[model samples]
Target: MKTVLFPVLISSALVLTACGGDDSPSKAPAPEVISQPTVAVKVAAAEPVSALERGEQIYKRCKACHTVNEGGRNRVGPNLWDIVGRDAAAVEDFAYSQAMEESGVVWTEENLSTYLLKPSAFVPGGRMAFAGLRDEYDRDAVIAYLKAQSPAAQ
Candidate 1:
Protein backbone atom coordinates (compact mmCIF):
# COMPACT_ATOMS: atom_id res chain seq x y z
CA MET A 1 0.00 0.00 0.00
CA LYS A 2 2.83 2.54 0.79
CA THR A 3 4.67 1.70 -2.44
CA VAL A 4 1.57 2.44 -4.58
CA LEU A 5 0.78 5.65 -2.66
CA PHE A 6 4.34 7.00 -3.06
CA PRO A 7 4.33 6.45 -6.88
CA VAL A 8 0.93 8.21 -7.23
CA LEU A 9 2.13 11.28 -5.20
CA ILE A 10 5.38 11.50 -7.22
CA SER A 11 3.46 11.45 -10.55
CA SER A 12 1.09 14.26 -9.34
CA ALA A 13 4.03 16.46 -8.22
CA LEU A 14 5.82 15.93 -11.62
CA VAL A 15 2.62 16.88 -13.57
CA LEU A 16 2.17 20.07 -11.48
CA THR A 17 5.81 21.10 -12.04
CA ALA A 18 5.45 20.65 -15.85
CA CYS A 19 2.58 23.23 -15.92
CA GLY A 20 3.90 26.84 -15.75
CA GLY A 21 2.93 29.05 -12.73
CA ASP A 22 0.77 32.21 -12.94
CA ASP A 23 3.90 34.44 -12.40
CA SER A 24 4.93 34.06 -16.13
CA PRO A 25 4.65 37.25 -18.33
CA SER A 26 2.17 37.56 -21.30
CA LYS A 27 2.69 39.32 -24.76
CA ALA A 28 0.53 41.89 -26.73
CA PRO A 29 -0.41 42.09 -30.50
CA ALA A 30 1.64 44.36 -32.92
CA PRO A 31 0.11 47.75 -33.95
CA GLU A 32 -1.49 48.22 -37.45
CA VAL A 33 -0.38 50.87 -40.06
CA ILE A 34 -2.95 52.96 -42.09
CA SER A 35 -2.54 55.34 -45.08
CA GLN A 36 -4.54 58.54 -46.03
CA PRO A 37 -5.27 60.07 -49.47
CA THR A 38 -3.46 63.30 -50.60
CA VAL A 39 -5.25 66.36 -52.02
CA ALA A 40 -4.17 69.35 -54.32
CA VAL A 41 -5.20 73.00 -53.79
CA LYS A 42 -5.24 76.13 -56.03
CA VAL A 43 -5.71 79.88 -55.37
CA ALA A 44 -6.99 82.69 -57.62
CA ALA A 45 -5.29 86.09 -58.14
CA ALA A 46 -6.83 89.57 -57.58
CA GLU A 47 -7.20 91.95 -60.54
CA PRO A 48 -7.78 95.70 -60.03
CA VAL A 49 -9.26 98.00 -62.72
CA SER A 50 -8.40 101.65 -63.49
CA ALA A 51 -10.14 104.29 -61.34
CA LEU A 52 -11.76 106.00 -64.37
CA GLU A 53 -13.60 102.86 -65.46
CA ARG A 54 -14.91 102.32 -61.95
CA GLY A 55 -15.69 106.03 -61.53
CA GLU A 56 -17.68 106.20 -64.79
CA GLN A 57 -20.00 103.47 -63.53
CA ILE A 58 -20.25 105.15 -60.13
CA TYR A 59 -20.96 108.60 -61.69
CA LYS A 60 -24.29 107.37 -63.13
CA ARG A 61 -25.83 108.22 -59.75
CA CYS A 62 -24.04 111.56 -59.60
CA LYS A 63 -25.37 112.76 -63.01
CA ALA A 64 -28.45 114.29 -61.40
CA CYS A 65 -26.43 116.76 -59.31
CA HIS A 66 -23.21 117.33 -61.25
CA THR A 67 -21.69 117.52 -64.76
CA VAL A 68 -18.15 116.60 -65.85
CA ASN A 69 -17.39 118.16 -69.26
CA GLU A 70 -16.21 121.50 -70.64
CA GLY A 71 -18.87 124.31 -70.53
CA GLY A 72 -20.80 122.12 -68.10
CA ARG A 73 -22.97 124.23 -65.83
CA ASN A 74 -23.93 123.64 -62.22
CA ARG A 75 -27.17 121.76 -61.59
CA VAL A 76 -28.33 121.00 -58.04
CA GLY A 77 -24.65 120.89 -57.08
CA PRO A 78 -21.72 122.66 -58.73
CA ASN A 79 -20.28 121.13 -61.90
CA LEU A 80 -17.63 118.51 -60.96
CA TRP A 81 -15.64 118.99 -64.20
CA ASP A 82 -11.92 118.90 -63.41
CA ILE A 83 -12.67 119.06 -59.67
CA VAL A 84 -10.06 116.55 -58.48
CA GLY A 85 -7.22 118.99 -57.71
CA ARG A 86 -9.51 122.05 -57.37
CA ASP A 87 -10.13 123.62 -53.98
CA ALA A 88 -13.36 122.94 -52.18
CA ALA A 89 -16.17 125.55 -52.54
CA ALA A 90 -14.17 127.35 -55.25
CA VAL A 91 -16.90 127.46 -57.92
CA GLU A 92 -17.51 131.12 -58.74
CA ASP A 93 -21.20 131.40 -59.70
CA PHE A 94 -22.63 128.74 -57.35
CA ALA A 95 -23.25 129.57 -53.72
CA TYR A 96 -21.31 127.48 -51.14
CA SER A 97 -21.71 127.11 -47.40
CA GLN A 98 -19.24 128.89 -45.10
CA ALA A 99 -18.47 125.51 -43.51
CA MET A 100 -17.38 124.09 -46.86
CA GLU A 101 -15.11 127.08 -47.49
CA GLU A 102 -13.63 126.90 -44.00
CA SER A 103 -13.33 123.08 -43.88
CA GLY A 104 -10.08 123.30 -45.91
CA VAL A 105 -10.36 119.68 -47.08
CA VAL A 106 -8.45 118.53 -50.20
CA TRP A 107 -10.35 116.32 -52.66
CA THR A 108 -7.96 113.38 -52.54
CA GLU A 109 -9.06 109.74 -52.99
CA GLU A 110 -9.19 109.32 -49.21
CA ASN A 111 -11.18 112.52 -48.65
CA LEU A 112 -13.55 111.88 -51.60
CA SER A 113 -14.34 108.36 -50.38
CA THR A 114 -15.06 109.63 -46.86
CA TYR A 115 -17.21 112.56 -48.09
CA LEU A 116 -19.05 110.38 -50.63
CA LEU A 117 -19.69 107.74 -48.00
CA LYS A 118 -21.20 110.31 -45.64
CA PRO A 119 -21.24 114.01 -46.52
CA SER A 120 -22.69 115.20 -43.20
CA ALA A 121 -20.20 113.02 -41.34
CA PHE A 122 -17.29 114.48 -43.33
CA VAL A 123 -18.54 118.05 -42.86
CA PRO A 124 -21.24 118.56 -40.26
CA GLY A 125 -22.48 121.79 -41.85
CA GLY A 126 -22.21 120.73 -45.51
CA ARG A 127 -25.21 121.40 -47.81
CA MET A 128 -24.84 118.43 -50.20
CA ALA A 129 -28.21 116.69 -49.81
CA PHE A 130 -27.28 113.38 -51.43
CA ALA A 131 -26.35 110.50 -49.10
CA GLY A 132 -22.98 108.85 -49.86
CA LEU A 133 -22.43 105.65 -51.85
CA ARG A 134 -22.52 102.75 -49.37
CA ASP A 135 -20.69 100.18 -51.51
CA GLU A 136 -16.89 100.26 -51.29
CA TYR A 137 -16.45 98.93 -54.84
CA ASP A 138 -18.67 101.72 -56.20
CA ARG A 139 -16.73 104.29 -54.20
CA ASP A 140 -13.42 103.01 -55.53
CA ALA A 141 -14.74 103.07 -59.09
CA VAL A 142 -16.05 106.64 -58.70
CA ILE A 143 -12.72 107.75 -57.25
CA ALA A 144 -10.90 106.06 -60.11
CA TYR A 145 -13.14 107.92 -62.60
CA LEU A 146 -12.47 111.22 -60.85
CA LYS A 147 -8.76 110.48 -60.87
CA ALA A 148 -8.94 109.61 -64.56
CA GLN A 149 -10.73 112.89 -65.26
CA SER A 150 -7.81 114.67 -63.65
CA PRO A 151 -5.19 115.85 -66.21
CA ALA A 152 -2.48 114.15 -64.13
CA ALA A 153 -3.77 110.57 -64.64
CA GLN A 154 -4.27 111.03 -68.39
Candidate 2:
Protein backbone atom coordinates (compact mmCIF):
# COMPACT_ATOMS: atom_id res chain seq x y z
CA MET A 1 0.00 0.00 0.00
CA LYS A 2 2.82 2.47 0.80
CA THR A 3 4.62 1.64 -2.49
CA VAL A 4 1.40 2.19 -4.53
CA LEU A 5 0.75 5.57 -2.80
CA PHE A 6 4.36 6.73 -3.54
CA PRO A 7 4.02 5.97 -7.32
CA VAL A 8 0.56 7.72 -7.50
CA LEU A 9 1.98 10.87 -5.77
CA ILE A 10 4.99 10.92 -8.22
CA SER A 11 2.68 10.61 -11.27
CA SER A 12 0.43 13.42 -10.02
CA ALA A 13 3.47 15.65 -9.45
CA LEU A 14 4.78 14.91 -12.98
CA VAL A 15 1.33 15.78 -14.52
CA LEU A 16 1.21 19.14 -12.58
CA THR A 17 4.74 20.00 -13.78
CA ALA A 18 3.80 19.26 -17.42
CA CYS A 19 0.75 21.62 -17.32
CA GLY A 20 2.03 25.04 -18.69
CA GLY A 21 1.01 28.60 -17.49
CA ASP A 22 -0.49 31.20 -19.95
CA ASP A 23 2.46 33.08 -21.60
CA SER A 24 0.51 35.67 -23.81
CA PRO A 25 0.54 39.35 -22.76
CA SER A 26 -2.72 41.36 -22.25
CA LYS A 27 -4.00 43.12 -25.48
CA ALA A 28 -5.17 46.78 -25.84
CA PRO A 29 -8.77 47.45 -26.95
CA ALA A 30 -9.14 47.98 -30.76
CA PRO A 31 -10.46 51.28 -32.14
CA GLU A 32 -13.91 51.30 -33.75
CA VAL A 33 -14.08 52.07 -37.53
CA ILE A 34 -16.97 54.38 -38.56
CA SER A 35 -18.27 54.16 -42.17
CA GLN A 36 -19.11 57.33 -44.11
CA PRO A 37 -22.55 57.89 -45.67
CA THR A 38 -22.91 56.90 -49.33
CA VAL A 39 -23.55 59.62 -51.90
CA ALA A 40 -25.42 59.43 -55.26
CA VAL A 41 -23.28 60.39 -58.24
CA LYS A 42 -24.45 62.17 -61.41
CA VAL A 43 -22.97 61.02 -64.74
CA ALA A 44 -22.36 63.12 -67.85
CA ALA A 45 -24.93 63.06 -70.65
CA ALA A 46 -24.43 60.74 -73.67
CA GLU A 47 -22.99 62.02 -76.96
CA PRO A 48 -25.35 62.96 -79.82
CA VAL A 49 -25.91 60.61 -82.78
CA SER A 50 -23.69 61.13 -85.84
CA ALA A 51 -24.65 60.80 -89.56
CA LEU A 52 -26.99 57.95 -90.59
CA GLU A 53 -24.71 55.68 -92.67
CA ARG A 54 -26.29 52.53 -91.28
CA GLY A 55 -29.65 54.27 -90.83
CA GLU A 56 -30.54 53.89 -94.53
CA GLN A 57 -30.45 50.15 -94.14
CA ILE A 58 -32.55 50.28 -90.96
CA TYR A 59 -35.08 52.69 -92.50
CA LYS A 60 -36.27 50.05 -94.98
CA ARG A 61 -38.91 48.83 -92.52
CA CYS A 62 -39.96 52.35 -91.54
CA LYS A 63 -40.20 53.50 -95.18
CA ALA A 64 -43.33 51.37 -95.59
CA CYS A 65 -45.27 53.71 -93.26
CA HIS A 66 -43.12 56.87 -93.06
CA THR A 67 -41.40 59.21 -95.50
CA VAL A 68 -38.28 61.18 -94.48
CA ASN A 69 -38.18 63.73 -97.30
CA GLU A 70 -39.68 67.14 -96.54
CA GLY A 71 -43.12 67.78 -98.08
CA GLY A 72 -43.57 64.02 -98.50
CA ARG A 73 -47.21 63.06 -98.11
CA ASN A 74 -48.44 60.84 -95.29
CA ARG A 75 -48.72 57.15 -96.07
CA VAL A 76 -50.59 54.76 -93.74
CA GLY A 77 -49.20 56.88 -90.91
CA PRO A 78 -48.05 60.50 -90.81
CA ASN A 79 -44.92 61.41 -92.78
CA LEU A 80 -41.90 61.22 -90.45
CA TRP A 81 -39.91 64.03 -92.10
CA ASP A 82 -37.98 65.77 -89.35
CA ILE A 83 -39.73 63.65 -86.72
CA VAL A 84 -37.18 63.95 -83.93
CA GLY A 85 -38.02 66.72 -81.41
CA ARG A 86 -41.45 67.10 -83.02
CA ASP A 87 -44.54 67.19 -80.81
CA ALA A 88 -46.39 63.88 -80.57
CA ALA A 89 -49.17 63.44 -83.15
CA ALA A 90 -48.69 66.97 -84.52
CA VAL A 91 -48.50 66.11 -88.21
CA GLU A 92 -50.43 68.71 -90.19
CA ASP A 93 -52.99 67.78 -92.85
CA PHE A 94 -53.16 64.24 -91.47
CA ALA A 95 -55.56 62.69 -89.01
CA TYR A 96 -53.97 61.39 -85.82
CA SER A 97 -55.29 58.90 -83.26
CA GLN A 98 -56.54 60.34 -79.97
CA ALA A 99 -54.13 58.09 -78.06
CA MET A 100 -51.11 59.56 -79.88
CA GLU A 101 -52.38 63.15 -79.57
CA GLU A 102 -53.06 62.70 -75.87
CA SER A 103 -49.70 61.10 -75.07
CA GLY A 104 -48.18 64.60 -74.93
CA VAL A 105 -44.73 63.12 -75.48
CA VAL A 106 -41.98 64.76 -77.54
CA TRP A 107 -39.97 62.65 -79.96
CA THR A 108 -36.45 62.56 -78.50
CA GLU A 109 -33.85 59.90 -79.26
CA GLU A 110 -34.70 57.91 -76.14
CA ASN A 111 -38.43 58.28 -76.70
CA LEU A 112 -38.17 57.42 -80.42
CA SER A 113 -36.09 54.32 -79.74
CA THR A 114 -38.60 53.08 -77.17
CA TYR A 115 -41.49 53.93 -79.48
CA LEU A 116 -39.89 52.13 -82.44
CA LEU A 117 -39.33 49.03 -80.35
CA LYS A 118 -42.99 48.81 -79.31
CA PRO A 119 -45.20 51.60 -80.60
CA SER A 120 -48.37 50.24 -78.99
CA ALA A 121 -46.65 49.94 -75.65
CA PHE A 122 -45.21 53.46 -75.88
CA VAL A 123 -48.53 55.08 -76.78
CA PRO A 124 -51.39 52.75 -75.98
CA GLY A 125 -54.23 52.94 -78.56
CA GLY A 126 -52.15 55.03 -81.00
CA ARG A 127 -52.62 54.21 -84.67
CA MET A 128 -49.15 53.55 -86.08
CA ALA A 129 -50.57 50.25 -87.53
CA PHE A 130 -47.18 48.51 -88.21
CA ALA A 131 -45.33 46.10 -85.93
CA GLY A 132 -42.39 47.56 -84.02
CA LEU A 133 -38.66 47.16 -84.74
CA ARG A 134 -37.29 44.71 -82.15
CA ASP A 135 -33.52 45.20 -82.54
CA GLU A 136 -31.88 47.92 -80.41
CA TYR A 137 -29.21 48.61 -83.07
CA ASP A 138 -31.85 49.01 -85.77
CA ARG A 139 -33.88 51.33 -83.53
CA ASP A 140 -30.72 53.42 -82.87
CA ALA A 141 -30.09 53.66 -86.61
CA VAL A 142 -33.68 54.73 -87.28
CA ILE A 143 -33.40 57.34 -84.52
CA ALA A 144 -30.19 58.60 -86.15
CA TYR A 145 -31.99 58.92 -89.48
CA LEU A 146 -34.85 60.86 -87.86
CA LYS A 147 -32.35 63.10 -86.05
CA ALA A 148 -30.60 63.79 -89.35
CA GLN A 149 -33.93 64.88 -90.82
CA SER A 150 -34.80 67.17 -87.88
CA PRO A 151 -34.74 70.88 -88.67
CA ALA A 152 -32.91 71.71 -85.46
CA ALA A 153 -30.45 68.84 -85.90
CA GLN A 154 -29.68 70.02 -89.47
Candidate 3:
Protein backbone atom coordinates (compact mmCIF):
# COMPACT_ATOMS: atom_id res chain seq x y z
CA MET A 1 0.00 0.00 0.00
CA LYS A 2 2.85 2.39 0.89
CA THR A 3 4.66 1.60 -2.39
CA VAL A 4 1.50 2.24 -4.43
CA LEU A 5 0.88 5.61 -2.68
CA PHE A 6 4.53 6.68 -3.19
CA PRO A 7 4.37 5.94 -6.97
CA VAL A 8 1.20 8.01 -7.37
CA LEU A 9 2.77 10.94 -5.47
CA ILE A 10 5.96 10.69 -7.61
CA SER A 11 3.93 10.61 -10.88
CA SER A 12 1.98 13.72 -9.86
CA ALA A 13 5.22 15.50 -8.94
CA LEU A 14 6.75 14.55 -12.31
CA VAL A 15 3.70 15.85 -14.25
CA LEU A 16 3.71 19.14 -12.27
CA THR A 17 7.52 19.53 -12.76
CA ALA A 18 7.16 18.99 -16.52
CA CYS A 19 4.43 21.68 -16.70
CA GLY A 20 6.35 24.27 -14.59
CA GLY A 21 9.35 25.81 -16.54
CA ASP A 22 8.90 27.63 -19.91
CA ASP A 23 10.27 25.06 -22.42
CA SER A 24 9.17 26.80 -25.66
CA PRO A 25 11.96 27.11 -28.25
CA SER A 26 10.94 30.75 -29.02
CA LYS A 27 10.90 31.62 -25.29
CA ALA A 28 14.32 30.00 -24.41
CA PRO A 29 16.38 32.22 -22.08
CA ALA A 30 18.98 34.31 -23.96
CA PRO A 31 22.57 33.06 -23.70
CA GLU A 32 24.29 34.72 -20.72
CA VAL A 33 26.62 37.61 -21.65
CA ILE A 34 29.35 37.56 -18.97
CA SER A 35 31.64 40.59 -18.93
CA GLN A 36 34.80 40.35 -16.83
CA PRO A 37 35.84 43.50 -15.01
CA THR A 38 38.97 45.18 -16.39
CA VAL A 39 41.53 45.88 -13.70
CA ALA A 40 44.36 48.36 -14.47
CA VAL A 41 47.74 47.33 -13.02
CA LYS A 42 50.84 49.51 -13.28
CA VAL A 43 54.05 47.57 -13.70
CA ALA A 44 57.37 49.19 -12.90
CA ALA A 45 60.50 48.41 -14.88
CA ALA A 46 62.97 46.32 -12.90
CA GLU A 47 66.16 48.08 -11.88
CA PRO A 48 69.32 46.41 -13.13
CA VAL A 49 71.62 45.24 -10.32
CA SER A 50 75.28 46.19 -10.55
CA ALA A 51 77.69 43.28 -11.02
CA LEU A 52 79.13 43.75 -7.52
CA GLU A 53 75.61 43.92 -6.04
CA ARG A 54 74.56 40.76 -7.82
CA GLY A 55 77.76 39.05 -6.73
CA GLU A 56 77.15 40.11 -3.13
CA GLN A 57 73.66 38.62 -3.28
CA ILE A 58 75.02 35.38 -4.73
CA TYR A 59 77.72 35.23 -2.03
CA LYS A 60 75.05 34.24 0.50
CA ARG A 61 75.61 30.65 -0.62
CA CYS A 62 79.24 30.83 0.52
CA LYS A 63 78.47 32.62 3.77
CA ALA A 64 78.06 29.33 5.60
CA CYS A 65 81.67 28.41 4.92
CA HIS A 66 83.30 31.80 4.46
CA THR A 67 83.31 35.39 5.70
CA VAL A 68 84.15 38.31 3.40
CA ASN A 69 84.72 41.11 5.92
CA GLU A 70 88.22 42.11 6.97
CA GLY A 71 89.65 39.90 9.74
CA GLY A 72 86.50 37.77 9.77
CA ARG A 73 86.83 34.27 11.25
CA ASN A 74 87.11 31.15 9.12
CA ARG A 75 84.50 28.38 8.97
CA VAL A 76 84.75 25.13 6.98
CA GLY A 77 86.37 27.35 4.37
CA PRO A 78 88.75 30.22 5.24
CA ASN A 79 87.82 33.84 5.80
CA LEU A 80 88.04 35.39 2.32
CA TRP A 81 88.93 38.91 3.45
CA ASP A 82 91.67 39.53 0.88
CA ILE A 83 91.07 36.55 -1.35
CA VAL A 84 91.17 38.42 -4.66
CA GLY A 85 94.97 38.63 -4.66
CA ARG A 86 95.82 36.03 -2.02
CA ASP A 87 97.28 32.56 -2.34
CA ALA A 88 94.96 29.56 -2.15
CA ALA A 89 94.87 27.59 1.14
CA ALA A 90 96.63 30.44 2.99
CA VAL A 91 94.25 30.85 5.90
CA GLU A 92 96.20 30.27 9.16
CA ASP A 93 93.76 28.21 11.23
CA PHE A 94 91.70 26.56 8.53
CA ALA A 95 92.71 23.10 7.36
CA TYR A 96 93.35 22.85 3.60
CA SER A 97 93.83 19.78 1.45
CA GLN A 98 97.34 18.89 0.20
CA ALA A 99 96.22 19.34 -3.41
CA MET A 100 95.04 22.94 -2.79
CA GLU A 101 98.19 23.85 -0.84
CA GLU A 102 100.43 22.54 -3.61
CA SER A 103 98.28 23.75 -6.54
CA GLY A 104 100.14 27.16 -6.58
CA VAL A 105 96.86 28.94 -7.35
CA VAL A 106 96.90 32.76 -7.11
CA TRP A 107 93.37 34.12 -6.76
CA THR A 108 92.98 36.32 -9.84
CA GLU A 109 89.52 37.07 -11.28
CA GLU A 110 89.97 34.47 -14.04
CA ASN A 111 91.36 31.85 -11.64
CA LEU A 112 88.50 32.44 -9.19
CA SER A 113 85.95 31.98 -11.99
CA THR A 114 87.52 28.68 -13.00
CA TYR A 115 87.76 27.44 -9.40
CA LEU A 116 84.20 28.50 -8.68
CA LEU A 117 83.05 26.66 -11.79
CA LYS A 118 84.16 23.31 -10.31
CA PRO A 119 86.24 23.37 -7.14
CA SER A 120 86.75 19.60 -7.11
CA ALA A 121 87.90 19.60 -10.73
CA PHE A 122 89.93 22.80 -10.35
CA VAL A 123 91.99 21.45 -7.45
CA PRO A 124 91.46 17.73 -7.34
CA GLY A 125 90.84 16.50 -3.73
CA GLY A 126 90.38 20.01 -2.34
CA ARG A 127 87.42 19.93 0.06
CA MET A 128 85.20 22.83 -1.09
CA ALA A 129 82.03 20.64 -1.23
CA PHE A 130 80.30 23.19 -3.50
CA ALA A 131 78.66 22.03 -6.71
CA GLY A 132 80.15 24.72 -8.98
CA LEU A 133 78.28 27.87 -10.04
CA ARG A 134 78.41 26.77 -13.77
CA ASP A 135 77.22 30.21 -14.94
CA GLU A 136 79.97 32.57 -16.21
CA TYR A 137 78.07 35.74 -15.32
CA ASP A 138 77.50 34.48 -11.78
CA ARG A 139 81.20 33.72 -11.38
CA ASP A 140 82.09 37.19 -12.63
CA ALA A 141 79.59 38.81 -10.30
CA VAL A 142 80.85 36.90 -7.25
CA ILE A 143 84.43 37.83 -8.16
CA ALA A 144 83.35 41.45 -8.35
CA TYR A 145 81.85 41.11 -4.87
CA LEU A 146 85.11 39.64 -3.57
CA LYS A 147 87.05 42.50 -5.09
CA ALA A 148 84.72 44.98 -3.44
CA GLN A 149 85.30 43.31 -0.06
CA SER A 150 89.08 43.63 -0.34
CA PRO A 151 91.02 46.26 1.60
CA ALA A 152 92.42 47.79 -1.59
CA ALA A 153 88.89 48.64 -2.69
CA GLN A 154 88.21 50.61 0.49
Candidate 4:
Protein backbone atom coordinates (compact mmCIF):
# COMPACT_ATOMS: atom_id res chain seq x y z
CA MET A 1 0.00 0.00 0.00
CA LYS A 2 2.83 2.43 0.84
CA THR A 3 4.70 1.68 -2.41
CA VAL A 4 1.49 2.24 -4.50
CA LEU A 5 0.49 5.33 -2.50
CA PHE A 6 3.97 6.95 -2.78
CA PRO A 7 4.04 6.57 -6.63
CA VAL A 8 0.44 7.85 -6.94
CA LEU A 9 1.24 10.93 -4.77
CA ILE A 10 4.44 11.56 -6.81
CA SER A 11 2.50 11.31 -10.14
CA SER A 12 -0.24 13.75 -8.92
CA ALA A 13 2.42 16.29 -7.70
CA LEU A 14 4.28 16.07 -11.06
CA VAL A 15 1.01 16.66 -13.01
CA LEU A 16 0.07 19.64 -10.80
CA THR A 17 3.62 21.16 -11.00
CA ALA A 18 3.64 20.90 -14.80
CA CYS A 19 0.16 22.47 -15.30
CA GLY A 20 0.21 25.09 -12.46
CA GLY A 21 3.71 26.47 -13.22
CA ASP A 22 4.29 30.01 -14.62
CA ASP A 23 5.97 28.50 -17.71
CA SER A 24 2.63 28.25 -19.67
CA PRO A 25 2.63 28.78 -23.45
CA SER A 26 2.61 32.49 -24.41
CA LYS A 27 0.07 34.21 -26.74
CA ALA A 28 1.11 35.06 -30.32
CA PRO A 29 3.05 38.36 -30.63
CA ALA A 30 1.11 41.45 -31.84
CA PRO A 31 1.66 42.31 -35.51
CA GLU A 32 4.13 45.12 -36.21
CA VAL A 33 2.33 48.47 -36.85
CA ILE A 34 3.86 50.78 -39.49
CA SER A 35 3.21 54.54 -39.64
CA GLN A 36 1.32 55.74 -42.74
CA PRO A 37 1.65 59.08 -44.54
CA THR A 38 -0.73 61.87 -43.50
CA VAL A 39 -2.28 62.81 -46.79
CA ALA A 40 -4.03 66.21 -47.14
CA VAL A 41 -6.98 65.46 -49.37
CA LYS A 42 -8.25 68.33 -51.53
CA VAL A 43 -12.03 68.33 -51.59
CA ALA A 44 -13.58 70.16 -54.53
CA ALA A 45 -16.63 72.25 -53.66
CA ALA A 46 -19.75 72.05 -55.83
CA GLU A 47 -20.55 75.16 -57.90
CA PRO A 48 -24.16 76.28 -58.09
CA VAL A 49 -25.88 76.06 -61.49
CA SER A 50 -26.56 79.39 -63.28
CA ALA A 51 -30.05 80.68 -62.52
CA LEU A 52 -31.03 80.52 -66.18
CA GLU A 53 -29.82 76.90 -66.40
CA ARG A 54 -31.68 75.92 -63.27
CA GLY A 55 -34.74 77.80 -64.48
CA GLU A 56 -34.57 75.96 -67.81
CA GLN A 57 -34.89 72.69 -65.92
CA ILE A 58 -37.79 74.02 -63.87
CA TYR A 59 -39.40 75.45 -67.02
CA LYS A 60 -39.71 71.94 -68.51
CA ARG A 61 -42.89 71.52 -66.48
CA CYS A 62 -44.20 74.91 -67.64
CA LYS A 63 -43.47 74.09 -71.32
CA ALA A 64 -46.74 72.15 -71.42
CA CYS A 65 -48.68 75.39 -71.07
CA HIS A 66 -46.53 78.50 -71.66
CA THR A 67 -44.27 79.33 -74.58
CA VAL A 68 -41.30 81.68 -74.12
CA ASN A 69 -40.36 82.18 -77.76
CA GLU A 70 -41.38 85.44 -79.48
CA GLY A 71 -44.51 85.14 -81.67
CA GLY A 72 -45.33 81.78 -80.05
CA ARG A 73 -49.08 81.04 -79.86
CA ASN A 74 -50.84 80.44 -76.58
CA ARG A 75 -51.64 76.87 -75.69
CA VAL A 76 -53.19 75.74 -72.39
CA GLY A 77 -51.61 78.85 -70.95
CA PRO A 78 -50.67 82.18 -72.53
CA ASN A 79 -47.49 82.77 -74.51
CA LEU A 80 -44.85 83.88 -72.02
CA TRP A 81 -42.45 85.56 -74.44
CA ASP A 82 -41.35 88.88 -72.93
CA ILE A 83 -43.62 88.13 -69.98
CA VAL A 84 -41.32 89.63 -67.42
CA GLY A 85 -42.20 93.26 -66.66
CA ARG A 86 -45.31 92.88 -68.82
CA ASP A 87 -48.78 93.42 -67.39
CA ALA A 88 -50.49 90.34 -66.00
CA ALA A 89 -53.25 88.72 -68.11
CA ALA A 90 -52.31 90.87 -71.12
CA VAL A 91 -51.97 88.15 -73.77
CA GLU A 92 -54.17 89.47 -76.58
CA ASP A 93 -56.22 86.45 -77.72
CA PHE A 94 -55.79 84.30 -74.59
CA ALA A 95 -58.73 84.47 -72.20
CA TYR A 96 -57.72 85.52 -68.68
CA SER A 97 -59.86 85.31 -65.58
CA GLN A 98 -61.58 88.45 -64.42
CA ALA A 99 -59.78 88.13 -61.14
CA MET A 100 -56.37 88.16 -62.83
CA GLU A 101 -57.18 90.76 -65.49
CA GLU A 102 -58.57 93.07 -62.86
CA SER A 103 -55.83 92.36 -60.30
CA GLY A 104 -53.86 95.28 -61.76
CA VAL A 105 -50.54 93.55 -61.21
CA VAL A 106 -47.41 93.76 -63.36
CA TRP A 107 -45.28 90.70 -64.05
CA THR A 108 -42.25 92.02 -62.18
CA GLU A 109 -39.83 89.54 -60.64
CA GLU A 110 -41.28 90.24 -57.20
CA ASN A 111 -44.85 89.83 -58.37
CA LEU A 112 -43.96 86.77 -60.44
CA SER A 113 -42.19 85.20 -57.48
CA THR A 114 -45.28 85.71 -55.34
CA TYR A 115 -47.59 84.53 -58.10
CA LEU A 116 -45.47 81.44 -58.85
CA LEU A 117 -45.43 80.48 -55.20
CA LYS A 118 -49.22 80.19 -55.34
CA PRO A 119 -51.09 81.47 -58.37
CA SER A 120 -54.57 81.31 -56.86
CA ALA A 121 -53.35 82.98 -53.68
CA PHE A 122 -51.80 85.81 -55.71
CA VAL A 123 -55.01 86.34 -57.70
CA PRO A 124 -58.07 84.76 -56.16
CA GLY A 125 -60.65 83.43 -58.67
CA GLY A 126 -57.98 83.34 -61.41
CA ARG A 127 -58.38 80.64 -64.08
CA MET A 128 -54.83 79.24 -64.06
CA ALA A 129 -55.00 75.51 -63.20
CA PHE A 130 -51.40 75.21 -61.93
CA ALA A 131 -50.97 74.36 -58.26
CA GLY A 132 -47.94 76.68 -58.38
CA LEU A 133 -44.25 76.15 -57.70
CA ARG A 134 -43.90 75.59 -53.98
CA ASP A 135 -40.12 75.67 -53.68
CA GLU A 136 -38.67 79.16 -53.41
CA TYR A 137 -35.66 78.03 -55.42
CA ASP A 138 -37.95 76.57 -58.11
CA ARG A 139 -39.95 79.80 -58.29
CA ASP A 140 -36.72 81.77 -58.60
CA ALA A 141 -35.52 79.40 -61.26
CA VAL A 142 -38.73 79.78 -63.26
CA ILE A 143 -38.45 83.55 -62.93
CA ALA A 144 -34.85 83.40 -64.06
CA TYR A 145 -35.84 81.24 -67.01
CA LEU A 146 -38.58 83.66 -67.95
CA LYS A 147 -36.23 86.62 -67.62
CA ALA A 148 -33.73 84.88 -69.90
CA GLN A 149 -36.39 84.69 -72.61
CA SER A 150 -37.77 88.21 -72.15
CA PRO A 151 -36.35 91.21 -74.07
CA ALA A 152 -35.66 92.82 -70.69
CA ALA A 153 -33.01 90.18 -70.04
CA GLN A 154 -31.03 91.12 -73.14
Candidate 1, 71-153: lDDT as tens digits: 68999888777777678887898888888989998887788888999999998898999888998878888877776665576
**Rank by lDDT (best first):** 3, 4, 2, 1
Model 2, residue 55: what's the lDDT?
84
Winner by TM-score: 3
Q: Model 2 Cα displacement at 17 (Å)?
A: 68
RMSD of each: 13.2, 12.1, 7.3, 9.9
Tens digit per residue, CA lDDT, model 4, 45-126: 9897987889999899988988889899999889999998899888989998789889999999999999998888999999
- Whichever of 2 and 4 has more TM-score, that candidate is 4
lDDT tens string, model 2, 24-138?
5535356688999999899998776544866877788778877888889898888888888889888878899989888999998899989988889999998877688898887
Misplaced by over 4 Å in model 4 are 1-47
Worst 10 residues of 1 by lDDT: 20-29
Clashes of each: 7, 0, 0, 0
- Model 1, residue 52: C-alpha shift (Å): 2.8
- Between candidates 2 and 3, which one is better according to lDDT? 3
Itemize residue pairs with steric clashes in candidate 2.
none
List, residue by residue over 1-154, the lDDT tens digit for candidate 3: 9999999999999987766656665554678999999999999989999999999999999999999898899888899998988998888888889999999999998899999999999999899899999999999999999999987899
Error of 4 at 114 (Å): 0.6
Q: What's the CA error at residue 150 for candidate 4, in Å?
A: 1.7
The parts of candidate 2 lying over 4 Å away from their true place are 1-51, 152-154
The predicted structure with the larger lDDT, 1 or 2, is 2
Per-model TM-score on C-alpha atoms: 0.63, 0.63, 0.72, 0.68
